[model samples]
Structures are given as structure tokens and as C-alpha cells.
Target: MSAESKPLSGLRVLVPRGGTWGELVSKALREQGASTVIAPLVDFGHTSEEDKLVDALHRLEAGDFQWMTATSATVVDVLAHHQAVIPKHTEVAVVGEATLQAFEAAGYEVARTPQDGDNTTEGLLKVWPEIETDEVLKVLTLRSDVAKPVLTEGLISRGHDVTQVVAFRTVGVPASVHIREDVQSGRINALLIASPAIAREVAKQFPDIPENTIVACVGPHTHEAAIDSGVKHTAEHVESDMKHALIETVESVIDQSDMLD
Candidate 1:
């Protein structure tokens, strides 16, 4: 390493997930000389309205909707549970490549994937499927329980009939004692806030996070969520994609040795 290298040297960050994902993020941070603390702060739970979602899945298999929107990877798991089938003619709109990968993992094909980075209601709306006829589109939205009805509402305003179903719920998971202690003690230089719920949890659990620790969100929506969650410090958007957002944020803030006076 050059003398001016390792901008993130001495920086310790907290990444919210572990296992393969954690390892991947840790590897990236280690290259930047930042030690990463792997602790997942949230987990996906069953949708609040199981029966409604189950019936929606049945209708999906029956070709009731012309298009179905998958806002997150967890929706793919719901399809797996019901052994859902998508007719060849039915258009499946995925939020992003991650969601597309989830569908493929669950043995489904994606007909349309969001092209933009903000892979949610706004992104899907930008790549809205074309309708050849005057008939209103029949759309099914499978989303998280806490997810706002942005897509459904937007489609409705566009004169489409949408049947929105809750695919899953997000539950908060407590961080390990060592993790919390490190965070509060300000040893952690940054905190990667992946979701709105995670932002809320951080606000609740780690109220005394270091003043200089970076609080970075994946994209604009999550940035808003962090603001809404009332994180005491300013929150910033590091990248549109989750995979590289944390690393990008750390690089932006870390002190560069070459800049030393």
C-alpha cells in the first residue's frame, strides 16, 4: 500500500447483515482499512394479512392480474410458499436486479425489471408496461407490510386497477452486546442503515451513536426514511445500489493521507 493509501484507515464501521452478505461487505471495507462489525438489526417476518396474501397468490396463479409488481426479494419467498405460477402472457415487473435474482432463485422468470436505481414505486412507474388497449390494467402488488402504497396509489391515479397484498413484515432484531457497546462507545466510525425500519431501530437502540459516525442510506427513499425516523444526525445517500452504498459512503468521509498538511 502507498503512503497516501487507505483513506479509511482507523475507521470501524457497522454493517447491518452477516453471513455471506456480511463477509462480502467486510471484505470491501477491509480493503479500505475499516474494520466492519457484522450484526443484522432486522429480519423479515410473515405478512400481517396471511389469508389475503394467500388468496392473492392463488389469483396470481389463476392469471387474474395482467401484471404483478414485486417490490422486494421477500415477495419471491411468498411465491415460493404458495408454489405460485405466472402464465407466460402475464408481465412480471421487478423492482431491480436483486428482486429479479430472487425471482430466479425461486424458479420464476422476470418479464420486466426496473431500469432505474431507485427500485421501488417510483422506479417501476418510470418503466411502466405499455397497454395496447383502452382497458384499465389489472395489477397485483406484493409488498412489505410497512411499505407505503406508493405503487398502488400511483397506478390507481393512472387509471389502473390494482390489488395490493402484503407479502411480509419487518421485525427488529437486537444487536449483540459487543456490537451495541462498540456503537455507543463511538468506536464504530459509521453505521449502514439499509432500511427505514433499521433506521427507526437505530434511533431507538443506539441513541448515542458517535457524532462523527456516518449514517448512510442506500438511496433516496431510504434517506427519507432515515430522516423520518428522526436520526439525530444528518443522514446521507451513499449509492443507489445497496451492495456498494456503504463502501461509497465510507470512502467519501474517510481522511485521505495525501491531503495531510
Candidate 2:
């Protein structure tokens, strides 16, 4: 394809998902002709905390919990690694389809999931009360270090004994010299913030991004973080999911730039 025909030709985008997720976003951006940079803001690794997770599994098998929630697919993987089992009687809820799929693959039935408009905590809360309250509901929440407390706090407010576990830690990856050089030289046109954690890390590493660069956040939370960090132009995905939102935001940015020409 000619350079002019390429969707993101002459644009450079940075993706900071911090692991396999970053790779997925990077690959998609590259296919669209955006020079992609992968700078993970966190790293995932197994830790001795598996014991606590194992204990949680025991609680699950004993039918001690009424509901289980997973925020990330990585949490599901960590649960599986510890051989966590979901009791047949326990209901499961997840933030995204990928997490639901992971639960299904692990032989658990998903009781609730966020639909098109309900991908946020507020969206999930609309249907949360429908769950039986008399059943001594113990909610096992699996997440990373920097997860939002909204979900767990909400569950607790509704009379659920919520056990929130940090399934993994988010550690920043040391940026390569090339990434720093490109970013400082104003070659990076836009930075895609997939999560609030990544956005915070980016703000810490590069306190002063070029004035002309655009900031596209995957969701409201990340968008807020970007704004808090003093990013001038910020956009949130109409759709809640990261992949779709990132692609749509990138396309929108490209279209708007073309219109200005």
C-alpha cells in the first residue's frame, strides 16, 4: 500500500500494557502503519503468595463464597496455576469477555459479565444487587497491584465478605535508549494508555511529553489519569474494551489530522 493510503502512516504510537497485552496492541498498531513502541509499565511473575491463593481456592471449594470476580485474564491464569477451583454453586463475574472465556476454559460457569454499555464498575453494579444476599456471600477478587478499589468496596458495602488478592505485581520495565530518544525527539505522535497503572508509570517516566503529542486512554479511569498528568489532548474509548477502543481512537486521531490538512 502507498504511504498515503496507510491508515496511520507518518504517525508513531506508544503502547504500554506491560506484558503480553502490550505485544498484542503493538502488533495491531504495526499492521496499520503506525510506528509502534512497546514500553511495558509492569511485569508479571509467580510468587510465594500462591499459598494465600491456594487457601482462597479451599474456601471456594468449600462453598464459602457466593461470588467470584476476576478483573484480568492474568488473574485467571494465576488462579489456574494454583489449581483454584470454582465450586459448582458459586457464581462468577468478570469485567471482560476474555476473563469470562478464561473462566469457561477452567470449567467455571460465568454468572454475569459487562455488556456493551456496562463494562465499568458502575455498569456491573446495576445487576449486582440481584444476587441473593442471604447466602453469606464471600467474594474472591483476583487482581494486580494497582487495581481500582471500587469493585471490592462496592461488594463490601453490599454485605459481602470480599477477599481481595493481588494476583500479580506491576513493575515498570526499563525503557530502552531508543524509546527515550524517539519520545524526547517528538517522533511519538500519540501514546496509548491501556490501563491507569501504565498511565501513571508513563507520567512518572516522561513528565514532559511533547506539547503536540496526543494521549489516548483506553477508558475513563485511564483518561482521568492522563489528564491528571497534564496531558493536553485526551480521548476515551466509546467502547470499554482496550483493543477496540485503542483502534478506534487511533483511527479517529488520524481522521481528525487529515481533516486539518
How accurate locally, in lDDT, is each candidate? 0.67, 0.64
Candidate 1 local lDDT, 1-261, one digit each (tens): 852366556666787754333455567677766777888887667877889988988888888898998766667666766777777678887664445666776667777655534544576677765633468999998888776777788888888889998787888888888888888788876787666777877888888777666776554556677788777663342332333545474333221110010
Over the stretch 1-261, how does candidate 2's per-residue lDDT look in tens digits? 876666666667887643334444566666666777777655666544667777777888899887888766567667666776777888888765445555677677888866554565556777765544565577888776666666788888877789987677666666677777777678876777666666766787776677666666655666777678765452442432434545574432221101110
Model 1, residue 238: C-alpha shift (Å) = 13
Question: Which clashing pairs does model 2 show?
Answer: none
* Per-prediction TM-score to the true structure, in the order listed: 0.71, 0.66
Number of the top-ranking candidate, with TM-score as the measure? 1
Candidate 2 C-alpha RMSD relative to the actual structure: 7.5
Pairs in clash, predicted candidate 1: none
- Candidate 2 regions with alpha-carbon error over 4 angstroms: 1-10, 18-35, 45-52, 61-63, 80-89, 101-109, 128-134, 185-187, 207-212, 217-261
